[model samples]
Structures are given as structure tokens and as C-alpha cells.
Target: MSMTNRLKVDRRDGKLVMAHFYVAFISLAIGGLAGLLQVLVRSGMFVLPAGIGYYQLLTLHGVVLALVLTTYFIMGFQIAAVSRTSGTLTSKQRKIGWTGFVIMTIGTILAAVMILLNEATVLYTFYAPLQAHSIFYIGLTLVIVGSWLGSAVILLKYRQWRKENHKQTSPLITFMAVVNSIMWIVATIGVAATVLLQLLPWSLGLVETINVGVSRTLFWYFGHPLVYFWLLPAYMAWYVIIPKIIGAKIFSDSLARFSFILFLLFSIPVGFHHQLMEPGIDASWKFIQVVLTFLVIIPSLMTAFSLFATFESYGRSKGAKGLFGWFKKLPWKDARFVVPFIGMVAFIPGGAGGIINASNQMNQVVHNTIWVTGHFHLTVATAVLLTFFGISYWLIPHLTGRTLTKAMNNLAITQGILWAVGMTFMSGAMHAAGLLGAPRRSSFSEYGGASIAAEWIPYQVAQAVGGSILFLSIILMLYIIINLAFFAPKGEQDFPIGEIAETAEKTPKILENWKIWIGITVLLILFAYTIPFIDMFHHAPPGSKGYKLW
Candidate 1:
């Protein structure tokens, strides 16, 4: 059957997907504005208005953009991808999705209100002994719960499809989506345990103090994988959508599935790499996690190879002349391809920084520094955000029956370039300044006018300029999306789903063995975390009293 026919049958699911995108864009607007304020404040060029402070804005920016925007967008994108590739969601599944969305939206509103009112300046991590209102933690808990519910729905549909199809391999997009959902469920258990068992009780005064080290351990347990959660949806586009956009098939279906499975197993256990700088965690355990972190990189490397091969083969098929000449044969003018391609390029540095941060020796130099900030911007901000922006150009039009105009397409390409240029200036300066001992999460000027402090001023100025450019780029992007959603002419659009290349071997049956993969993932997590967690509880210091520095 045609995609249009399938979409017609799944019209209700499309509306749910649109709702998710709507919320995501709203988050981008609010968070993007907060980002501008942050750069200006950090540059020491502009003071915040009365009743608004740096930490508050920082918390708002982190929560909205990092947590809210990524979660909503991924859910929407995954649902759409699954529906398009597998089959329409059942009415029950749609209801489950909507229920989760409503719960999450309410939770976000409650948490956002707390932040805006200066009652929750704990930052997105919300680590103790810095405390916020009980409602703040409660709201975030609800958000996690909602997401879990939604994930359950997706899993149910996937299981149903497997039952009906019997021995057939799952559709690649659907397979990827299910893997991500399972990963999310596994990852969130850490945060949920910490919040419901530790933080929430303390916040509600049911407990007198909080286990600062234990809470942080749990947070990071979820924290690093949280990045992977944000990233995998973008990977879905790169693997499945980008090849199609480039007039090529996926290089290897088996490899793509294996990579996601690797992510499922390796992504969570590596969170201890984030805690290398902290005490209480043993060095041996940290070293083990560092090794696991490197293991996770293998899948990404495989993806890189596969993508390059796809491009090379496609170029050769198109009659390209030389080794590097194939680069020019790519569909660069297509915003759908160019935007995400740039995002993929940005990940080169971002992934490199991640490796540095994971290393025990190198992390000391960059931990709590602006270098970490630069690293994430290159990653989540540029790589992940730009991919979503690229996806949006087609996704919005696809769902809304709107034609993406040529002018809007050009504007999107321009937006992607501006973002890349801006991030280069901003993150590059941040990295340089961090190397010279500049701190992150501060809004200070002139470290008492020390000579070394003076060295940071030029980089700070560059950060401000770059941030302004990024803000402007986001504004243009929003304008384009708004037009596409509400004002563009109604029309049908192709939803790109790359095929497996004819030259590639059939996907291995071992790749589809979910039972084995899940078991191995569970075992790895147990091996990595069980002993450390037991040690933490057994030897833990007295819980710390809460503080409200803001």
C-alpha cells in the first residue's frame, strides 16, 4: 500500500505526533530565549532584570531544552516512524500515548512555574544539598512516569506486530524505535529509584536529610544515557532517513541493528565515567566504566563507516570520477540532507570531547569547566538539535499536509549553516578558555582582575557574539516551522525510509534476537553497578541537610 493510504488510516496517530511536535517547539522557543540571556550574562555584558537571576535562567534553559524538548520530540518522531514503517497504532495505543502526553505537559507546566517563580533554582540535575520545593521533584517524577507509560504502549504495539508477523524481521525503523524505548525504560529506572526513594521523600520532609553521594550516583546513572536517549532518534534519521534522501539504501541492515543493540547494552553501564572526579566511587570501578564508555563508541564508529560507504556507493553509481569527487555528488542543496549532514560532522568533535571527558586523567582538566559546556553544545545542541531541525522540515509538512516551499527550504539550509558557524565560534572559545582554567556555571567578571582572568575576556566576547547568532538562527527556524505548520499550501509529501542495499547480505537472525540482547544488557548493568551501589549504601556518610542558596 502507498504511504498516503497508510497515513490516511493512521490519521489519528498523526494528530498525536503533531501534538508532541507542538510541545517540543514551544520548549525550543522558551529555552532558546533563556540561552540568549545566559550567554549575555556569562559575557558580563548584560545584567538580568529584577526578579530574575542567573541560576533560575540556567535551570530553565537546561530543563526546557535538554529534558523537555528532547523527550517530546523523540516520542513524536519515534511514533511517527513506527507508524509509517510498521503499522498504525491501535486506538488503545493512541489513548495511552495521549494520556502520557497530558500527564507530561502538566508536569512540565508545574515544574516550569516553580522555576520561573524562583522556587526551583536547583538546576536540571537538582543534586543535593541544594533543595527546591517538593512540587518541583514531584513534577519531574510525573514526567518520568508519563514517559514510561508511553514507552510501555510502544512496546506493546511492537510485541503485537511480532506476534502477527511470526518469523519476519521487524521493520528497521520500528526495530530502532523499540530498542530506544527499551533503553529509555532501563535508563530511567535509576532516576526513578533515586527520585521516588530518596529525593522525593527528603523534599517532602518525610526524611530529614538526603544522601548527596548516593543521589548523585543515581542521577549520573541515568544522566549519561540520557544523552544517548536524546541522540538515538537523530541516529534513526541518519541511518534510515539520510540514505533515502541521498538516493541510496542503508549500507547494512544487520550493522544498523547491531549498533543500536550495542547502545542498549553499553550506554547505561558507562555513567560512572561522569563520576570519575568525585570521591566515594572507587578508582577501579571508574576505570571499568571508562572502558565501557569506549566500548559504546564502537557502534558510533560503525555507523560512520556505514554512512560513508552508503555515500561512496551512491556516488559511484551516479558516475562520479575519483576518490574524493563523490563528495560533490551528494545532494547538498537539499535541506533535509545538508542540515543533518552538518550535524553529523559536528559530532566528530563532540564525540572526541566525550572520549576526553571519559578518561580519568583528562577529565580532571575539563570537569566543571567551560570545556564540558563546549563539548555538549557540539553534541546535543548542534548535532542533536540540528538533526531535529532537519527532520522538522519534512515531518511538519508530512503530518500537516503542507508543502515546504523552496524559499523555506533555502532558509532552513541557511539556518543550519549559521548554527554551525555560531557553534564553532562559541564552543571553540569555550574550549580554549576552559584550558586556561576558566570555570563553568558562573557569571563572574575578572577573577579579581588576575592576569590569567584577563586572558578569558576575548573568548567570553566571542561566546556572546556566537550565542546571538545562534539565537537569531533559532528565530528564523521557528518562523519557518510556524509557516509550514499553519500557512503553507496543503499537499502530499514523501516520507523517506531507506531500503537495504541490494548488495548487502540479509540481516542476521541473531540481530533480531531481543531475548539474548536484553539478557546481556541486564547482566552488563548488574556487573557494572551492583557492587558500587552496595558499597555506597554500606559506607555512606550521614545524609546532608538541604540548602537553598538562591
Candidate 2:
């Protein structure tokens, strides 16, 4: 191609990209630090003097990192998807998207500051009766509104692409973006409703006392699906980006579609799984949520088997033999491949724990303990974070039109190992501690009075060591990304799969239509949630003496 005819890539430079990544990394780094600190405080290795600092950090770490990092990079990934498939975005769309990011960042910062100043220490859930500063609610509103706008910009451009390529079905990446938009539209409603009706009124003192049970029901109504919101993007990275980099088609595109559909349908009604420990709700209602929870597991298991089968198929194509021997044939040296691969390996055990948590009997034992935190951290922080890390490494070269240095690649691999190893140790310790009845969110425990101080001491110490290794992994990742962004050579490099440009001809549409599934999702959600929600309305105030805890 002539110089003038050569396609130009959209540069991920400018102040916006810089600002987004900077805020994202800082938030995540702080969150990672807080994780270690919590483990330390709980393990009795270090004393945490009672005050607002620990709680505020914990609160800020959970809410900010959960909201900011996930959404910010979902926008970034949208950009990558569009660029790879459609060349570049119009200047107008890019500005709107980044503007939304800026608003979200400021909102996140405001909320963080409020917590740090001890104005909002009610934990991540803005559950009723425990009101925050006006600024905290205001900040949260801004964050939600900003994310909506970001989703709008991405989806608008995606739809425009669809219009031009009438025959083409949405690419899996773009389909995920679409699903994310739809999910958010449904998912944010409960929290938004709670913020407006319950939290805002309570915070402003317009209400003398809010119904805590009703508020919690609504908050978690928005809460559980919010987890799927964090996870869908990670799964998108696995389904779309990984296969592209590894030179394989997705093993079962139909299965991938089912996974997304299942998420849309089941994620909403299962929120009561979090409420198993609380009293007041009818056992029958909780039992319904529990059954739906197990039903939801079918999709997760299907996903696990499908992705594993995808890897097996790839290995077989490369002339590998034996059942699990395909694991060795994977591109282990490539950070993009290895990080997510390791993440999935860790997710298997952690996910099983999640299944256990969904059970009424198992949940009663582990609820409000270190075990809950450990299970989720393993699934969310470790699994989702590793997937995002791999996606960043996988896409950064294309985004910058440069290949990362070999040294950077090696650093990434080493960090992935450390991250996985650290999580295994930490989560394993947490499981034991939870079984021993160690409480979460408490800084210390008196060992002698009804507690085994001697036995608890060693577990706490192991947690600290594990946490230290985790912190080191974060530092290593920061160093590698910084090096890749600044020092790596810039210019075209073959992406192994070929240059990631939109194919010139339109491809045929297969299963991209959304209506049938959306209808099913609506029906499934109603079927799953209708009885429990109705029962909540008919039941007496949850704290009545007749109410009982499981």
C-alpha cells in the first residue's frame, strides 16, 4: 500500500487515556494494598488501631475499584473492539466516551475522599438506616450516570457499524458490549432506586427511620447482578481476545451465546443468596433463591466445560495427544495466553466454593466470615483481574502499534505466577480461618476467651506472608505496564493472527438477534423472583420476634 493509502490507527495517546489508566492503576494498587492490610489485621500479625482509617480504606477500596476500574476499562476495551473491527472511531464519539470517564473518575474520587474522612463507612453497599454524606450519594449518582453515558457512546457506534454491514452478525466482542449495556440498564435500576428513594431520603434526614429490610432487599437486588457486570467483560476477553491471539476459533460459539443468555436470565433473581444469614424473610422465599442459585450454576459449569473444550480443540489442532496433555501445548510463554489460562485454573476451585456458598446449609457456616471474602476475592479479584491483565497485555501492543519488549513479556509471566500462587495461599488460609469462626471486618480477636489463640496465630501469619507476595505481584505488573507504555518500541508488528482491521466484505448474520432471548430473560427473571419478592411484601417487618436465622 502507498504511504497515503496505508491505514492509520487511532492512537491511544492524549491526556484522557493517560488519566484513565493512571486513576485505574492507582485505585487497583490501593485496593490490593487494603487486601493485604485486611489479612494482616485479621491474622493478628499486625495490630490495627481502631479508627476510621481501616474501615474507610476498606470501603473505598471495595466500591471505587469495583466501579471505576471495571467501567473505565470496559470503555477502553470498547475502543479496542471498534478499532480492531472498524478501523477507528469518529472524533465526536471518542470525546463523549472520555468525558464520561472523566466524570466517573471524579465521582469515584469524591466518594473515596468522603470515606477516608469518615463520612461514609457503611461498607460498599449503601444499605438503608446507615446513611452517608450527601456528597457520597451525589458522587455515586454521578458515577452511575457517567457509566450510562459511556455505555451509550460505545453501543451507538457499534449499532452504526451494524447498519452498514447489514449481513454481518455482531462480533463476540461487540455482542458482549451490547450485552453489558443491556445488563447495566437492568442492573443499575435497584441501586438507583435505593439511592433515590431510600438512601437519599435517609441521608437528608427526610425519613426518621427507613425500612432496613426493604432497603437491603433492593440494594442486593442491584448488587448480585453487578458482580456479573464485572465478570462479563472478563469473559469477553477470554472468548474473543484469547482465541484471536492463540490462532483458534472459539470451540463452540453457540455455547458462548448460551453462557451470555444464561447470565442475563439468572443473574438478577439470585440476589437473595446473600441474605441467607439474615433473619425475618420466610424460609420458603430463601429456599426459592437457593434453588435458583443452583440452577444458575448449570450455566457456569457449562461455561467451564466449553472453555476447557476450546483449549482442548486448540491443542488437538496442534497435534497434541492425551486427555489433559493439551495444557502443555498452550502458548505458555505468551503473557496473554498464560495469565488467563492460570486464572481459569484458579477459578475452578474458587468457583466450586461459590457453589457451596449458594447452598443454605454451607452458607450458614461461612457467612460473615473470612471464607466469603476469600471465595469472592479468588473468583473476582484473582480471576477477573488476571483476565483483565491478560487483555491489557494482549491489546496494548495493538493500541500503541508496538510490540512489548521480551523482558516485559518475561516480567508479565513471572507476575502471573506470583499472583496465582499468592491467591492460593491466602484463600486457603482464609477458608481454614472461616471454618474456625474468624470474623471478617474486625481488626483483632482475643484468643484466650473462647477462641484458640495459639491455633489462630499461625493461620494469621500465613495470610500476611501470602499478602506480601500479592503486593509484590501488583508492583511487578505496574512496572511492566509502565515500561510497555513508555519505553517499548512503536510501529507496526504482525499480531500473529494478522493485522486487526475490519474485514472489507460483510459477513453473514447468524445468531446476533437479541429479541427472543431478552423475552426469555424477562420471563425467567419473573419466574425466579416473583414469589420471593411478593412474600417480602406480605411478611411482617423482618425483625419481629417470630423471625428466625438459619
By lDDT, who's the top model here? 1
Per-residue lDDT for 80-190 in model 1, tens only? Answer: 888887778888888999999999898899899999999899998888888888888888988998898778777877887788788888889889989999999999999
Give TM per candidate.
0.97, 0.89
- Per-residue lDDT tens digits for candidate 2, residues 1-550, read 2101123335642234445666777777877877777767766656556664666666876776677777676666655565545545567767777778878877888888888788998787755555689889878887888788777765776777778667656555666677777787777877887787767766887765555666787777788888888788778777766776777666565666667777877788777889988765678777877787777677778778767766787788899888887778888888888998888787888888988888889888988987887887788878888988887674655555667777888889999999988887888888888888876655554553544556666777778888889999999988877766666788664332221223223332434666776777677667766776576556745555122212
- The alpha-carbon lDDT assigned to residue 384 of candidate 1 equals 97
lDDT of 1 at 174: 85
lDDT of 2: 0.72
The RMSD of every model to the true structure, in order and in angstroms, is: 2.1, 4.3
Q: Against the correct fold, how does model 2 do in TM-score?
A: 0.89
Off by over 4 Å in 2: 1-9, 12-19, 48-52, 445-450, 493-510, 530-550
Q: Positional deviation of 243 in candidate 2, in angstroms?
A: 2.0
Single out the weakest 10-residue window by summed lDDT for candidate 1. 541-550
